[model samples]
Target: MLLPPKDSVLRQASFTNFWISRILSSTSFQMLSVAIGWQMYALTHDAFSLGFVGLAQFIPMVLLTFVVGHAADRFDRRKIVCLCQLIEGGIAALLLVGNMAGWLGREQILLAAAILGACRAFEGPSSSALLPQLVPKHILQQAIAWSTSAGQTAQILGPSLGGLLYSLGASCVYGAATIALLTAGILTCFIRVERSERKTEPVSLRSVFLGLEFVYRHPAILGTISLDLFAVLLGGATALLPIFAQDILHTGPWGLGLMRTAPAVGALLMSLILAYYPLQRAVGLKLFAALAVFGLATMLFAISTNLVVSLVALLLTGASDVVSVVIRSSLVQLQTPDEMRGRVNAVNSLFIGTSNQLGEFESGVLAGFIGPVPAAFLGGLGTIAVAGLWMYLFPSLRRLRSLSES
Candidate 1:
């Protein structure tokens, strides 16, 4: 019998640890997010407040991303990661207490959600920057794929768990999330860090902005990042999923969980297939096409009445999202040098953070105004339109070849 390569065992171990950490951290945070959204909407029946939930964290993230990125470059990344994990655990614990005491009115819950987002703002860049340190540079792409798979897998499981737990009460969900975050902190303690390879120049706000400027000037890097950002920003209907599950689909919390997980199921399967075989050929064209598919999937989901149809739509949406993530992350990692990775990634965080959290805000506002279905459909159309505009605007992105070929 023919067997796989001899190095497969070593590769699998690194992949396992890398992915397990992602799953744990993502599950802790996402479960909290779904629960917060579910509980807040239940209490207030307002989508705008749901938007506010993201605003709280995003403001802090935008403010601190440069500092956090600088710190990641300057300090031991493993320790920085551990500290963030611990802070998140503390935040989660506070949320649990707020939920349990019945002291958490909508205002208090919003405050807690903001604080959690603040922690995540720091956590995200550090975690992303830490990946290259975990594996050989050759397998960095694989590590990213596995990490996305892990995150999506958690996305699949976490919301369902959150919805089920939320049915029992918000306290249960918050408590479980807190425990998961604390465990994440404990796991970070196990990640050993060598001294940073980054060169420390005197840190200044102007220096940080230099990194942002660099991203702007690099078309392949900026273009790919913007493609993903705008695509997801306009098309992402996550904030309105609760409405679809309850009002449209005529299902309860369980259905909401299923909808949340649907994308992950699609992304995970796509990632697994791509892991063994690279998606390197004609990557640029594929990226644009993926976003187009993403827009179409969201549009289909917006009109979908059947549970199975909605699930399939969301699954395609997730798969497309994964494509965007890989292409964008690869562009950044390839263009960035080891010394500037932290600062550059910090800027990347701002781009992505604004897109995701602000996208949530956009979804909530649009849904509140036009109704959830129309908002989602319109958002998808907007995403497709942006991709078309981008294709015309960025000639460099269209011309990009594989990193190996380059």
Candidate 2:
């Protein structure tokens, strides 16, 4: 009997390695985030301080996004990813040791978390670009969906696991993160990325301007990304979840875990559905409608005090957000030229990462001033208003009929 070609075996190995790395990396990242949030809350009890933690993480990524994007377009992605995973592994080890030694003070943990954010600044764009090299262009959408689903899966389990582990002891959270990172490191060793042609010319500030120019020039790409960014920035109620769990909902760490998992659970289900059927029609309209639903869901969650009701609202919020994400990702992928993909995706990441962290900041800041409940409810209302304004401003997006139109 004839056997599969050697190249086929290599490709399989590479793809398997990539996904395994994704799973482990995601698990560690989520668990670490949960641990950080819980620890910070325990230490400071102030919402603004939690918000500052997010600000610390966002600054480095925003500052370095373009440079990292340029490098992703220029370098061997596998090597870049390997180096990042190694750096992240060391950071996890440091956290583990500090916790074990009873030296993981709040100030030290905050500094370490900031360093972790700096490492992620380099990692995100490079990893985003590397996927296209591993899979065929035909399956790129599916690959993105699958990768997102893996992240959602990690988000679903990691927080609950972190809470359980934290109850055992703070060291347990770091210990689990260490194991996850080691697994990712081992998997990173097996990935093989093909080298592409690179321009011999040196990069400069002018070259970065070209990317900004392209993004501004593309109405569809610019509009979709902007809409999601604004919607999430205004509507994200996740920062207040801990307050809801502890005070309003009358639960503890476990409730926080459920709140974290609720959105991921909905997102994972929506991902599976989209994977099978895909979004082939009225993409932009769908995106607008989804964000509207997301805003409404957030509003409901903000008002509700019951744990089950809050979780249900979060589930719907996540489902709506997934629709927006898939549409925006497809737009970014299909609209860009091959060489410019990294820069555009970098720009895209800036918006996404900013929305998330800054949303946390907004929630925390507003919560401190107006109190958490009113702040959350008002934010959700603002998100809906933003969505309406965006729909009015971008007529082409509201009328968008198909993915191929991009």
Candidate 3:
């Protein structure tokens, strides 16, 4: 596929549509999370049930990881993403109906979570693999930065929007999400990629597992992926925000929405900066430095009782996280072969899913046992420890100088 000319990324109609669609899709997804989290907590009032919600969603992704990667490599990635968005829209409608009819119980909520997770398992990897096709190679990294900005913008808006809508009613949030997702799907249908890759390979266990194998073969890729996994697995504090908002923070859903938006505000600013003036030198050291900063920020959030301090800590966490994310995402795409891109990205998503969804579950369970403050505090300590250990164990990753480096 020939990319657009050298000037701007958004100039390409396909890329522009994709970018806007990303905003819509991501915004809806983020909004759904806030609604689900708040609604579940309102219904159950148990910290453990909040974590259970994450686990329910996560299990489907874990089960479908290998299979989803194969589908991305074998099928039309754009179409796959389109289908996922449509399905998600339907799910949102279901939630709306359930909410309006007053039968959306814990069982219904968890089931919906699981179904949405399965769809995302496919959507995320397909979109990751499809991104490079829309822009010139020289600006791929910048496109990624802009792409990160799109998602961060959604995060910035989604939670707060969701929280606000909840004041009107849960059905309003779901209704808005449904509209956004459907519009996103329509936008995706406009994306036209050159379908030149051969899909002749038969489905087999060996083929499905190839992405996992490829990641292991590249030490740099392995290190970055695992580093994110461990760091987020330990440092995820967003999961406990409900407890904080309701109990410690003593705020309503509106306050929870603002709390969720805080990190995204920081992330949006940082992503815009990286898009314009990207990292140039000592990329490796910068990665570690960002990781360390993320850990410290998590620690700060853990102990803080004041809303301002906690929001500040989350802001730092998001800013620092985007640094590692952009570096890792660029490196992963740059390093992988086009034929293997889908599978590799799927492997990447697997780690991401584990860290995010499972991490939420872990935070919930730990919070249930020890309390949210102690759970978050220990998790921050664990993140710092992982950063140190990874630096020692993956010297090549620590020593890497550029995304182009093997």
Taking all chains together, each candidate's TM-score versus the true structure is 0.84, 0.86, 0.87
Q: Which stretches of candidate 1 lie over 4 Å from their true place?
A: 1-15, 34-52, 94-112, 166-171, 193-196, 240-257, 303-305, 361-375, 404-406
lDDT string, candidate 3, 267-350, tens digits: 888998888877877888899999999999998988888888988999999999999999999988889877788899989988
User: What does the lDDT come to for candidate 3?
Assistant: 0.88
TM-score of 2: 0.86
RMSD of 2: 3.8
Query: Judged by lDDT, which candidate is best?
Result: 3
Reference-based TM-score, model 1 = 0.84
The whole-model lDDT of each prediction reads 0.78, 0.80, 0.88
lDDT of 1: 0.78
Candidate 3 worst ten-residue window by lDDT? 1-10
Distance from true position, residue 88, model 1, in Å? 1.8
lDDT of 2 by residue, 38-100 (tens): 888887798887876776777888888888778777777677777777777788788888877
